[model samples]
Structures are given as structure tokens and as C-alpha cells.
Target: MGKARANTIVANTIVPIAGEDEGDSRLPSRLRKWGSEAHLSSAVARLEALLADRGFERMPWLAVAMLAGIGIWFALPGPGEWLIALGLCGLPAGLALIAMRGDDRALLRNAAVAVPLMIAAGIVLIWARSALIGTEPVAGPRVAVVEALVLEREEQPARDRVRLIVATRDPLDARPIRARLNVPEEMDDPRLTAGAQFRAKLRLIPPQRAAVPGGYDFARAAWFDGLAASGSLLEQPAITREGGGIAGWRSRLAEHVREQVGRFSGTASAAIAATLITGDRGAIPDSDGQAMRDAGLAHMLSISGLHVGAIVAIAWLVVVRVGALFPWLALRVRLPLAAAGTGALAGIAYTLLTGAALPTVRACLAALLVVGALALGRQALSLRLIALAAMGVMLFWPEAVIGPSFQLSFAAVIAIVAFHNSRFVAWLRGKRGEGRGEGRLERLLHAGLLLFLTGLVVEAALTPLVLFHFQRSGVYGSLANVIAIPLMTGLTLPVLIGGLVFDAVGWGAPFWWAGAKSLDLIIALAHGTSSLPGAVLQLPQIALWAVLACVAGGLWLALWSGRLRLWGLAPLAIGLPALFLARPADLLIEQSGRNAALLAPDGRLYLLRNSTSFSAEAMVEAMGKGAQYGVEPFAEFPEWPGARCNGVFCQFEAEGRVLLVAQRPAEVPYGAMVAACARADIVIASRRLPADCQPAMLKADSSLLARRGGLAVDLSNGTTRAVRPQGDRHGW
Candidate 1:
């Protein structure tokens, strides 16, 4: 018999002891019968108790890891050295993991072992990069060659300019970084596309950062895009063909697929197919994407765990069913192994299609873990296995740990696995068909039920992350998932397979129109379902305590059972009220180049500027958030109602309604109508402010909130005192 059959035998033999409910809380199977193992388990339990006594837990360790990530962000080389140093940082953590194999592994603090190793790896990566890269260039004049690889020459909404990533090469430079240059100029937009490359003799200087108050540090964005320096098109002297290694092949394939779809279908259909296949939604209009986001079907668009798992599952099923029909093939290679291999292939193909983005990398890691386990005949997968997989991948690619996709993907998976294992250990218990064969619908029903429960568990699990990163809640998300997920699994998966198959064959293939029509219908379903007005729940910018409460509550629910769930509600119950009470601003002055938005304390959201500008829309969206929670809004008070006025303010409606604005008028006579001047409510400056803009609050009773880039000033509760967001001397 093959390993799958052998495992099935062991699994069945073990299942008689493990899967069914004895209605007993503490019962051991074959592992428990190992009396010698008792000592080890007890020692591990004692160590866990000690850790509990010391107030150590996973969440705090998570915070520590993030702070370390922040440090890494500041410490790493300008751009080029990041890749080389990144792999080295996991050395310490990877080394520490080896100790878990010992008999007394339970006694040692895993975090103490792991975190040091992790930090050491980080330090090594950081030090090596910074030292070798030698002296990062600053934003100043430098004689350099501009090598630009145009990644995607697409027009941005509202702006006529085309955004392009010019691949730069600097051999003589201290640090060699391949970066994307953002040329926001519109006149030179239409000519460039994906495979285009340009070279120029231009002064490329390091990116700029916020030197003073109310400036959008262009350098920060440039840094995120790996663009270490910036310069305009000084002189386009030459044109060279550039290749993107793996990414180049993937981009070319993506373009080919997109063109194939477009020639056969409309632009929207092609765009949708490209988004699903290549993970490039830059071509998709913002309005369409935003509508999708509003509808809770946004996850379907992202190439995360769900998408990968869907592909794997479908591939595995097809391979298994087909292999079973081929008696000779099945006899030679076991069906389960064939299915697993097929799943692996699908997972890898999905990763390649998505340009191998970090999130997809993590997803592939996770999918590979499960598929590997199946091939290895690991019948009983545990939380330890899942955690080990996550840690292994993260340590291997530690930089991914800080990305939102990494955190949320692992978070959801961890929560679901934890919940499923805890509750369903004896899942086959107290059932009528415990020993009987189950039908397809019965299995489907069970799987659907599990998915529903997991969705709820995962959402609660990821609440902290969602709030911190996205600044919103998906109250309707579970409901949305319960309805849309089934469609995605059943309809969407089949359509993608059909499309892929059709692509491989000629245009005469019958699957082409069928797949395209199926895809079109799925799109229609999502559009119709997501059009519901109350499909999403938006929340406010909340305090750290609320976030802590949410995490604490999640831990309780995940780790504890029965009545403990009720206890978990306490943090959330209290946290919600606190969030409502802590409305940070009375009036929000959202600055746009065209018009500003004013959100009053009572929650009236109005725009000062009516012009259609990026800044204006951004401000309106923000102020509209204040309106969501019934913040009192004072009526329209645009200083430039008819004229182009530069400022907007709110003042003593009756006596003490504090006015907020970007600029403080030099001549406002009323002392009672005190302006938020030196103590600004909010500041938006076209030019950077001087270092000395930091000033004490001039308050009779109102408070002050002032910030100058990194420098900050904040007065508390009508007190003339100030506090920084971070407790440092430079806070005020």
C-alpha cells in the first residue's frame, strides 16, 4: 500500500481513539499512553505557567517585532542593500528554533530565544547594508546617468500626467539601486508603456523628506517605491532595452494575456481577467475598484490566501478525479500524491501570475505547508505546525512581517486553525452518520458550515489589524462572505479554469465563450450584490487602548472557551464606548489645492472648496467619516465661498466654539474668538515651515494640537502644557 493508504490506516486506527467524543475533557490516545512523555508535558505546562506569571504573551511579542521592523526601516541602506541584508536577519531566529527539539524545550522561553536571533539577523542585515552601501546620498545636485525602465505608463485620474517607473542604473554611485522614477509631468505622458526604457544625463539626487511642518515628504513615497533618488528628464540621450528578470517575464506574459482577452472581449472584461490573473489593477479605473471595495468583494481581487487556496483546491480535485479514472496511472502513482502535486503546481503558477508579490509569497508558503503535510502523510496537523510554517516563512522573509498583507493573512489563518482545532477535536461525536459514508451535498454542507464559522473567527481575530491599517470595520463583511464566498468557490473557480484552458488552446475552442460568459456573469453578480447601500461599516481613528482591547478580546476568544467568550466581550464593550467618547478633533480642516473640508464637532461634514482636486476629495472623504458618527457639523463656512480664499475657520458659535484653520489671521480682534494659530488645530503649507514654528499654546480655555513634520506640540484639556505623540523632548 502507498503512504496515503498507510496513513489512512493509521489515521483510521487513531481516529477511533481521537476523533470521537468520549465527552471527557482530558483523554489521551496513543501519545497519551506514552507514560514517559508525561514528565515532558508537565514540565512544559509548568514553564507556560511561569510565563503567564511574568505577563508574557504572543501579542506583546508581536508589538516588539513591529518596533524592530520600524528600526529596520530606518537602519537599512538607501535601497540596493535591502535585498542582500534582508535574508541574513533571520539567522538568529532560525538558529534559536533549533532548540525546540530538545526534551526540556518547554522550560526555555521561546520568545527569548527567538526574538534575539531575529533582532541579530535584523542587525546583521542593517549593518551590512548601511556599512557596505556607504553614505546615503542626500537631496542635492549630483552628476549622474538616468536609466529609466518604464514599468507601466498609465494616466492617473484627475491628473493629466502619466505615472511611470524609470529603471535607474548608477555604477559609479556609492549605492547601486534599481528604482522607479515618478515623472508626474503630463506633456511627456502618452509615449511610454511597460517594456520601454530611457537613459538621460540628469542630476538625480536622493529623495526629499519632511524638514518642517505641513509638507508631504516626497522622499517617503519615493523610499517606499525603492526610488532612492529623483530627477527630471534632463536630456534623453539614448534608449536601451531593459529586462526585469522574473518580473519581466511575468509582466510580458501578463500583457500578452491582457491583449488576448481584449481582442476577444471588451476592455472591462480584459481588465478583470488581467486583475484576476496577473494581480495588476493599475489599468482598472479607480471608481470601479472603489465600488468593489465598498461591496466587500475586494478580497476576491487581491491575490491572497483565498485566491491561492481556491486555485489549489480546484486543481487538486480535478487531478484526483481524473487520476482515479486512469487505473494504470493511479496504480503507478497514488491518487492522493498526484492530487497534492497538482495542487502544488497550481499554487506555484498562481504565485508567478501575481508577479510574486510578498503577500502571494506568504500565501504560497502556507499552501505549500498544507500540501507538503498531505504528501508527508501528516494526518493530524496542529497549531504548532501552522505556527512553525508561519515563523519559517516570516524569518526567511522578515521584511514581509511588517506589510499589512503578511500580518492579516497569517492572522486570519492562525485564528481559524486555532478555533477549528479547539472546538472540533471530537467533531465526529454525537452524530447520526459517524460511522457511515457521507454524500457529496453532506460534505459540501459540512465544508460550508466550517467556512462560515472560520470567517467569523478570522474577522474577530483580525479586528486589531483592520482598525490599525485600514481604519475601518467590516461589520457586514461576514454576511457578505457567507453569500459571495460560495459563488466565488463554485462559479468563479470553474470560470478561471475554463479561461486558462481556453487560453492554451486556439480561438476556435468552445470553452472560450463559455468561460468569458461565466466570468461576465460572476462580475455581474458581484456588482449587483455589492451595490447594497449598507454593505460596509466604516469606523473612526481610535486610541491605542481600544486596539489593545480588541486584541485582548481576540486572544481570550481564541485561547479560552465556553463562558470565557462572555468575558472576552468586556474589553470590546468598554472599548466601543471609549472610541465614541474620544473624538479627537472638533473641526477637521482638510486642505485641497481646490477646496478644503470642514468637519465640525457635532458631525456636520461640509466642503469649503468645491473644485475637483485630489486634496479636496481626500479631505471630503475624511470629514465625511466624522459625519458617520454623528459629529455635530457647524454650517458651511468656506472663507472663499465665491472667491479663492486661502483659509477656513470655525469660531465661538455662541461663546466658546473654537475655530480651526490652516493660517491664523494677523488681525482678528476678539480675544474670545481665539484662533488656533501658534497652537494650530491643523496646518497645511505649500512651503515648509521654519524649525521655530514650534510655539506655546495661546489659550484662554481652548486646547492646541501642533505638528511640524517630526516635531510636535499638543496642549491638554485647556492646559497650557504640551505633550508629544511620542514621549520625547522634541515632542513639543
Candidate 2:
């Protein structure tokens, strides 16, 4: 019977080839001969079988195609009207093809036509979204007396600073604009709160661009967040109106939580408590934040999926237990439905209270979907649901497609779901179910193993993204998560929530103490694990294509089922090594051309300027050496190997090419400058050089740097790449 069924499956997958039609005279003889071959026919049949097996699982591919379109929109040099037009034209044709009803033979043909259309539609959607939210950035630095309403306020007690997001009328056009203002805490008025109108003397500047090539783009982020400018307050603000809104309430609640927690615990614990309750992370100390990042526990601090899920679960359990106590009320109203509704409400309320960050919003959406599934007696956790949630997020916030938060959160959940749904895991579950008489210790061991495996899979999924964005990832994250996750979800978070709730009744001290102690333990674990040798894996900057390849490979592995998914390993094998194998540029020139960094043969980075700045630190990070080999000022070691300086003209020789940097051209003789340029393959000067002083290969001066922005040069091949290419006019 098995052999017969297998034969039936094979027969079903086989489809007639075009070459099989003898009446088609246009067919090449070679193609007809190849189609007649049994092996070729078998290969086609196997591919068809794979597609057929995918069934509804193919839905996730639509999300992938949409994401590709969004990426293309961002990659274009300017507004992509041509691309949008093409997509819009193809939409109807693609829809017609998809709507055509056919047997298994037509599946591949339909997909080939529909996928590209979906990608085009994706591009169109993102372009429209960008246009809708587009706002002109602040033109330049200026000091003005601005009247604005505070939207949000963040207090940094350690730094004695307060940051405010304010909505104000633009002085140029009187259009509504949002500005981020930093004010000294001492200058801040006690009456200042969200919704309070105020007037202040402020110095505002256009948002900053990336300090180094391929580094974070604060300008782009600011653009998406609707921030027109950012600067510090020049004078204390005078409140024009009292605040009374949800934002005001949130600020007051956060402050209250912090004060109450601090009364029983240290300031660190209080800060964490405030963060957990209100998503106010400004209070977290830099040292504690760094430790959390190094130990890979940083996600715990973010009010994301784990936190939202816990809140929902706790709410559901509480409602169900309360319903059970009242048997008469439970009889008429379905307890599970009631519980699901209550849980969803809690998730939504918590999401709003935490400022509705993208991750939290996504989690809340997913939780709502899960509640709906439960109420409808459908599968609660599946790839289809995740795909739906992702599509929903991208529909509104298309820019998030490129963010690390969206990528990491979705990737981790997808990996977890995919891993647990594997046949091997299902088989293990079946085996465990059969052994229902197992001892309590055995059950605990099984649960622990499952947690460890889940953490391992999530860590593996997030590693590439972490490395791509931050240039570093924790090596012991999986093991740390195994211990930390349970402590957080089962004890600390619940206790913290309880403390906040009962504090109104003056009976929250014990809960606060317990929560603080748990936080202390988690913090200690982070520090201990982070202190271990090689706990963090520092990698060089990965190429954009390599990271995309890794993402594609991961999606392929997670979205598909069966032996065909093993093909994902091919790209993973190639992309993972590429992360470590990437080499830094031989020379880095800052955008202003006033400073630069040179990579020595010994792997040390030397900065041309004596002072370290953001550009210099970024260069060191790009070199993949962490803080162990901090950047050294060239003046400190001017006579070192492969380079020399005499306070005016510095010469560097790398990869058989000589480069000259003229720091003090006025001090040097004209003849010496010309002579140095003649011998050098590349010349860089603080000021524009005369035509006669041009180098053989390339020359970069203040004028050239101003036009091209920051540059990275590879002396080995004498190629230079600019951060901002000439003619670039992207909105961000």
C-alpha cells in the first residue's frame, strides 16, 4: 500500500513539458531531447512535489517579496516613480494570473507571475507611506524663541538632563513640527509636563548624519520619527498651560513607580522598575545598560514580546481562576472566551502605557490575534499568524522593515515557531506523551532541555542581525537566556507588576523587595557572564549583500518544511564566514577632511587628530578590534613602522603605495609640497591643493571631501568609496 501511494504521489507531481508537443516546431532539438530524458523528468517532478507540499505555508513568501520591494525603495537614489508606475501597471496582470483556477501543473507558473507583482506592490506601498510621512528637515542651526507643547519627557537623573519631544509651529511656515530638545535638569521648570504649553529660547540644528560610512544614520531615524530638529535649550522654559493628558499621567506614574521602588531598593532597581512599567529607559545607568548588552540580556529591558506575553498570560490565568470561583457566572459565560478577551485588553492597555513602541505594538497585535484564535477554536501559534502580524506592521510603518528591532524580533519568533514545529520535535513530543508516568524530576529535565533548545535556536537566528548592526554578539547568550528568561517571566516581572498595583493600597513594600532582589540576581548574572573571556564575539562590518543573503537563507530554512529546507545551509555557510573575513579600509577620511584614520599592518588604527571623536571611535569599531586596541593618535607615534611625520607633512606606505598628508601646508615650502606629491600615489590635505601638487593616483582635499562626504580608501587596489555619493538627493 505504501509503495502504491508513493507511486501515486510521483505521478501526481509529473507534468507534461512543452517539448513533449511534437507539433511545436519552434522548439530546439536539444531541449526536446533533454525533456525526453528520464532523469530530467524526475527532477521536474521532485520540484513540483516540493511546491505542492508547501501548500498554505507559501503565504510567508509574500511577506518576503514585500520586504524586498521596501528595500528597493530605500535603495533607489531618489523618488522611484518609474518603479512605482511599473508595479501599478503589472498589478492587474499579476492578479489575473493568480486568480486563474488550475491543477497542480499551473502552480509554478502562477507563482512566477504573482511574486514579482507582489514585490512591485510592496515598492508602491512603501513609497506611498514615505511620501505620506515626509517632512522637511531643519535647514540649519538657528536660535529662536519657540512656543511648543511637550509631547513626551525623558529624565536622566545621573546626567542631570531632561529630554523633551515637543510639537511646535515652524517659524518659517507655521506648520506643525516636532523637535527634540535637551535641557539641563536644573533649568527645567517643575510644572513642565506632557501637554503643557511652554515658550523657551532654543538652539535647534538639523539632525546629524552618520559620523562614519555605514554607521547609524541618526538623520534617517529622526526623519521617520517626525523630528525636524534637535538641540539644547538656551534658557529655562516658562509653562504657559498646565498638563492633563495620558502622556502627563504616564510621566507621573513612571516617577511614582521609581520613587516607590527606590524607597526599598537601590537606584538601579528603581530605574529598572520604572522601565518595566513605563518604558522609560533614560534612568538606566550607562554601566548597567552596557552590562545588559554584553550579557545578551538587553532584550529583557525592552518591553517587547516576552514582557507582553507574560502580562497577557497572567491576566488570562487570573480571569479564569476568578471565573472558576463563581460557578453560576461561569455557566452562562464561556470562561476561556472571557479570559482571552481580558488578556487582550490587558495587552492593549500595557502597550499604550509603554508608549506603543514598534516592538510592543507588534507583540500586542500578535497577542490579540492569538486571543481571537482561541475564541474561534483555531491554532493560536503558526507562521501564518506571524506573517499576518508582520504584514500589518509593514503596512503602517514600512520604514521599520530595515530596522534591527523589527528584524530581530520577528526573526527570533519565527525561528522559535519553526524549530518547535519540526518533525523531530513533534516526534519527541509524541514519545514524551506516551510516557505519561515519568517521574517529576524527568519532567523537569525535559522542560529544561526544551528551554535550552529554544534559546539556542533564537540566539542562532539573531546572531547575524546583532553582528550586522552592532558588530558584536554575546557568545554565551543561549545559556544565559535559559536561566534569565524563567526568572524574569515567572518571578521578577509578575512581582514588579504586583508591586505597582498594590502600592496604591500601601501594601507593596514586600513585593517591591522581592522584585528588587530578583533584579539584582539577574544583573549579577549579566555581569558575571559578561566578564568571562570570549563571552562576546566581535566581528568586522559585514557587507550589505552578505547580511541580506543570511536573512534570505534564514527565511528559507524557517518558512519551508522537509529535506528541501537543507538548501538554506548553503548560503548560511557562505555568509557566516564572510562576517569575520571582511577587512577594514586602509584609510578613512572624515567628512570634514580635518581628521582621518590609517590602518597599520599590525591591525592598529591610528587617528590623524590628537583628539578622539565619534568618527574615530566608529573607525575603531569598523576595524573589529573592540576596545582592546583603542585608536592611537598619530602624533603620539609619528615615527612608527610604515609611517612618519615631522609636524607638517606625514607620509604613509601601505600595500606598496605611498600616501602623503599635508597637515600644515603653510609651514612647508612650496617645492617640498610639490616634491612630496610627485612621489606619493595619493595625497590628502587639510586645504585645497594646487594643480601642480596633485598626486599620481588620487587627491582628497577640503573641497573634494565637502563634495563627496566621508571616504574609505583601499590602498591595495586604490579604490575609494564615498559615504554620500555626488548627486545624492534622498529625503533622509
Tens digits of per-residue lDDT, candidate 2, 695-719, equal 8888888778756667888888888
**Native-structure RMSD, model 1:** 14.1
Report lDDT (CA) for all predictions.
0.54, 0.81
Top candidate (TM-score): 2
Relative to the true structure, candidate 1 reaches a TM of 0.68
Clashes of each: 19, 0
TM-score of each: 0.68, 0.88
Error of 1 at 291 (Å): 2.6
Candidate 2 minimal-lDDT segment of 10 residues: 628-637
lDDT of 2: 0.81
lDDT of model 2 at position 282: 83
